[model samples]
Target: MLVHLLYASRAAHTMSGQDLVAILKQSREHNAGAGLTGLLCHSDGVFMQLLEGGRDAVNARYQRIASDPRHKDVILLSYAEIAEREFAGWTMGQVNLHRLNPGLVLKYSATSHLDPYSMSGRAMLSLFRELVSSGAIECS
Candidate 1:
């Protein structure tokens, strides 16, 4: 069975541009080899990620992420068996929320900021879909 997991974590410390780049690079390669696909959004020192794949693979990956030193306050937002992958084409898509339009954020999140902590997992997923559809965010 396939599973989808959404989680939010605070950065252990402020991440520089190079830090984010390195994370994405590693994630893409690792996810592709593991048959996983997902979207990662970063903003205001928080990381929100959606991972979809075989149940074991997704759970294992989430466990690793939860224990990573780079992440703090890891919170599972949602996890469940899903009939389809929402980001199947993306090995590890990335979005820098700071660059996104405020209007789009407000439209879906009722705020001009990317505050995933205040939003439900379903809401955050919808926001990401809208951002992708409107060309406001692109997967790497």
Candidate 2:
């Protein structure tokens, strides 16, 4: 089965721009090596990621993310089985939320931000798509 996991983590205050870049690099390498696909969106000190891959592969990646020191308050948002990969065009694509205009957030999230565990994968991705299409979120 193709597992899709949505998770949020509170980024540590010490994370620098370089550290974010490094994390994205690592995500790309790992996702490509494991044949996983995903989209990661970050905003307001929150790291929300959607990972799609084989059960074992996805779980393995989640374990690695859980141990990363750059973040805390890790929480699983949702998990589901998918028949096809939604992010086939992405390796380990990243979208920085800070680039978004505030209006975009209001349009997609109903609020200025999202609460961890309050949204399902479907709802989260819908919001993600809006932001992506609006040029509010940019790939890294």
Candidate 3:
């Protein structure tokens, strides 16, 4: 069955531009081979990601992510079987919150910032969908 998992985590430290690029490259390659598609948003040392694919693949990937030393306080926000993929066009779409619209951020959360911890998993997913529709996010 197809499933989608949403999770959030804090970076162990501020990531450099090169580190982010490497991460995106590796994620796109790894997810493509694993038959996963999703969106990832990062800002201010926090990461919110959604992974959609076969239940086993998604869960396995999430487990790896949870154990990765680069992330701390990993929290599984949502996980369930889904009728269809929400981010099927990309292996791993990326959104750097610095380039995102402040208004949209405020629309979802109480503040004009990316704080998935403050919003429900559904709210975070909706925000990502809106950003994609608005061309605010760049997909690999």
* Highest TM-score scorer: 3
Q: What TM-score against the true fold does each predicted structure earn?
A: 0.92, 0.81, 0.95
Candidate 1 lDDT for residue 136: 57
**Clash number for candidate 2:** 0
Q: For all the candidates, what are their Cα RMSDs to the real structure?
A: 1.5, 2.5, 1.1
Local accuracy by lDDT, each model? 0.86, 0.75, 0.89
For residue 58, model 3's alpha carbon misses the true position, in angstroms, by: 0.2
The residue-by-residue lDDT of candidate 1 on 88-132, one tens digit each, is 988988875556888877876767777878888888878878767
Candidate 1 colliding pairs: none
Badly placed stretches (over 4 Å) of model 2 are: 96-101, 108-110, 114-122, 135-140
**Which residue segments of model 1 deviate by more than 4 Å?**
96-99
Show where candidate 3 strays beyond 4 Å: 96-98
lDDT of 2 by residue, 19-123 (tens): 778878888887899988888776667788888899999999888889978778888877888899877767777775557665655655557666545555567
Model 1: worst 10 consecutive residues (lDDT sum): 131-140
